[model samples]
Target: MYLYKFNDPEKALDCFTAFISRFPESGNITLVYYLAYEAAGKAGKASQAETLKDELIRKFPDSDYAKGLQDPEYFKKVDSDLRTVDRMYAEAYELYQNVYYKEALARCEDILQQFPGSKMSSYVLFLRAMCIVNLQPADEARIALNEVLAAQPTKRIQTVVNGILASMDVGDKPVLYADAEMYDARYLKSVRNWTFDEEKHAENTEEDRENPYKVNKEEEYCVVILLPEDMKTMQVLHLQTRLTFLNAALKAEQKDEKGDYQVKKEDLWYKTTALQIEPFANYGEAAVYLNRVAVDKTLLKNFKGARYRIFAISKTNFSVLKRLKNAEQYVDFFVTNYFDDRGQGEIITGRQGAAAHLFKYEADEKHDFVLMVPYRQVNVKKMAELLHGIEPAFALEKETYDDRYEMVVVKNVGTQVQSMEYLQLVSRNKEIFDRLSGTSSYMFTITQSNLGILLENQNIEEYMKFFDDNYQRNQSGEVGVGDGDFVYAKSVAHKFVLFYPNTIDPFKLKTTFEEFNFAGLMVNNVKYDDEHDCMVVSGFRNKEEAMRYFQTAVDNRKLFRSLRNVDYRNFIISDSNFDTMCEKKEIEQYLQFFKKYYLE
Candidate 1:
């Protein structure tokens, strides 16, 4: 009865075979005799069906089952119904071949009901189970496969179903980190099940209990610290530790009416923590955040002049982001974007117009490069001329703020180049520089506020003559000196010196500058004084050659320190008040301060 309920006629036939053998002479076996014939027909055993039918008619001619077999018209209708079922099976197979699994499944269900006791019923049920594979979820479809298995399907069908079940296991998928969804590949690999055992689960529970913020299983944001591949593991570990501490210990200074937190520099418990290092909901937000950080030199000082990258995975399962492949892909973006931004910054900052010494640190191939047209109208002709040496590839721009800002995507032309400095070296055309710099020192902005007047249209000699008069008039006031050029008092030096305070590690500072590839400056000597606790870096170069450059550095420092409440000068390696000490030839002043710690 159970076998018949589940449509397992083949298994029911096996039961009858056992019963007939055990009770060969039982008088009440007439019901079993008729059922055996019907079961054999349903199980697709034609020879067994014919034999059962013959026995029923020859031995029990007076029985109702034998009388039904005597009707020729009934047999003819059965044969016609078999042909119609065969056609339906063909159509279902055709639909399955075309990937129309839903329609194929519907047709299979119809055939199963219309020909419930047909000889081809088992084969049709098998088709229905396989079709469900494409149309239904793995667990739900497995139920249909189990039904087919109950009916004693062919060995070939059983093998295919077993293979599918093996593939459905969750352990077979790849694992990734929680933050990987920010990139193009939202999910990559599967995270390992670390808490699969009771002991491990207990350990995780204890760790969570000790943690400051309760771990929310519903959703979490995983913060991952990004750094250069060549960076020391100890440095990375140190940064990760500090970042974790800051996230837990720090609170915002104030919240706006809308509840957005305004985190000021003083509100931070850790002074070295980056203010720009906020949580990002997606890659788009991360990209903008990074670009803003790259542009703002003050933000770089927030980390005490340490170079680092940080990214966030917004509102996702940590297990989903732990895939190794996703971690690789996310890190690859840092490498690619770094070089891209470097190239762009060179053009945007107008570094080409100034002498090399003014730049405290140079850019290497690894530095972030990017070209940005500030959210305003720009002269297309001047922009084209600035990029004269390099080939311009078509950039796909993402429109932001109602098309006020066009975020041009990095292309092969920008990233494929060796380095931003390499481009400056090879493509720095003196003629182009003279033409543009003579008009307006600011390369990205317009000289005049007229819509039709482009920078290229202005006369170079007249513009400079006009600019000089205005520059001298306001030299002591608000207006900046054009091209960041400066004239300083003459000095005697057969060498150059770069001094840094004890706030940051000198070795790390050296590495950071080495990565920048500062244009004219080279590390000639490094002296670490234990007594003063300061590092003095001296470069062997004729000061006469780099006088104009260092003069610009001095002037920029004076301007930077003049800004109200600007404490960045104390920590920053470049353009710091240390330069003011250096300007006064006060090497002893720094050495004297360090002596308080060491010599005392």
Candidate 2:
């Protein structure tokens, strides 16, 4: 009974078969035959199932089992259908294991079409829902799971569905909070033009002049704003007003690309005019100017709780964007116009080692020419489409760019621009160049460990791919605790813990762990022991129960290859050391298990 309840029907079937063989003439022999029949059916032994059914009916015709087996032909058909469904399910599962999601989904759909109201309906429905989850977006998958839920599935199926739901919500909300104090160093230099280098042009040959699509230059300023979702109408007005004021203040001193003098300065923003500062050349200077500008406390107060990173775009880059229709043209115009001394402006002076903590801007490196402006009109995929050889890396928060921009570092900027002869001006220091390029790279806000991987790989595509894959894996598990929050001192005693070996792929380990988590076998919490460079899983009630489950997993070979070394480490927590492993949070549901089952 325990083995069957634990989902090991094959082992339970063996036990039942042995029991019936020894007690053939016992008073409860008919019951034994019936039990064996059920066990055989569950274990997918159609021949054994039919034989047991026949034995129960022939030996004890007056018994309830015999009465239930009255319709032999109907029973045979039921057995045949059950075997067919099991074979189809196994094929579908195999497809899923190979990552052939489309094929797996097709197989599941076929089962639904062929066996609409069979006994395997609930399990089939669950399988279909899981296939949809793997095949579609989270929202679509959620809808499918809800349909399964509507069918009122078995407790096991319900638990699995609920677990999937719980996993979908992990890290869906914003975690990085921002307010007025979070402005970066480059917010004030939005109006300035990029400093063109005469020396860079002096070094350029005739080839550079003729083929102009290549550039290894940086933008002067990029201001990013991290905004909260659903900005109020007044907040939008205030932001517009601030931008208008800043531009108005710079019009008198700054020259247009045509070298036309600006219109006379108007006192449109009287508060900012009092500083008597000209258009900002440096970000630090602009920061100082903004601090001095006497804007209304009420108007400034509006941005206190709001999240926004306003990019202080350079006049040159801003002009380029305004003139260009798409990224392809944007790239073409920059390469043709600014490739030589004819259009190159003056080199920036004195600014070095300046950094923006709130946004992503480095003063010393050459900036990436590609910009993902906050405007909704700037479509990332369109740009990627126009520039075929190019690919995007990571997208910022949906609120940051209004779901319009993706931050991409060009690894290999295609030289073929609009059928023109173009040269490739690749940056030598891509990392430093990107930093100084004034593009925002902090949108993902990855962890230190992930940061290490990015630095090691240095391929933005690889980094973003790993990030996305990790995010999906994190969203498929019951225990959705942040890995960074793992505390050794806070671990509880007598709790079940899977002490893993030090050597293991962290990503693979996490994925395998999620697969093992189910209804009764819940993962209450997780902890990453950084000092030992391993994972500690503690949440189950006692050592004995935890060990029993662990042994069963080993016997069933339900572990990843990396975890197959059963002697690598202990799988259960000792009573003396369990609670002392870490402290417990009062809010965690796992603590209740300790209080309920162990405290008394």
**Model 1 per-residue lDDT tens digits across residues 477-573:** 2221111222111121222334444444434434333322233344322333432223222242323444444455445544233233422222112
Worst 10 residues of 1 by lDDT: 263-272
Identify the candidate with maximal TM-score.
2
Whole-structure CA lDDT of model 1: 0.42
Report the lDDT of model 1 for residue 90: 71
- Model 2 TM-score on a 0 to 1 scale: 0.21
Model 2, position 61, has a per-residue lDDT of: 84
TM-score of each: 0.20, 0.21
Q: State the lDDT of candidate 2 residue by residue for 1-600, as single tens digits.
A: 423335666776776677688867654466557667877888899999999888888889876457657854654565567667767976776555434456767888898899887656766677777767755667778888998888777665688788878877783411221222112211222112111234335555443455323232343333222233334423543443344334334443556521111112111110111112233454453433333222323323344433222222344554454333233233344334543532111110001101111122222322223323334434555443433333244222222322433443332222223111111111222232233233333222243333334444343443333333333223322111122222211112334455554555544554445445432342332443442223344445544556566566656555657777543433444333334444542223333433333333
Name the regions of candidate 2 deviating beyond 4 angstroms: 1-116, 119-496, 500-505, 516-530, 533-545, 555-568, 574-577, 582-600
Q: What is candidate 1's CA lDDT for residue 431?
A: 48
Error of 2 at 155 (Å): 20
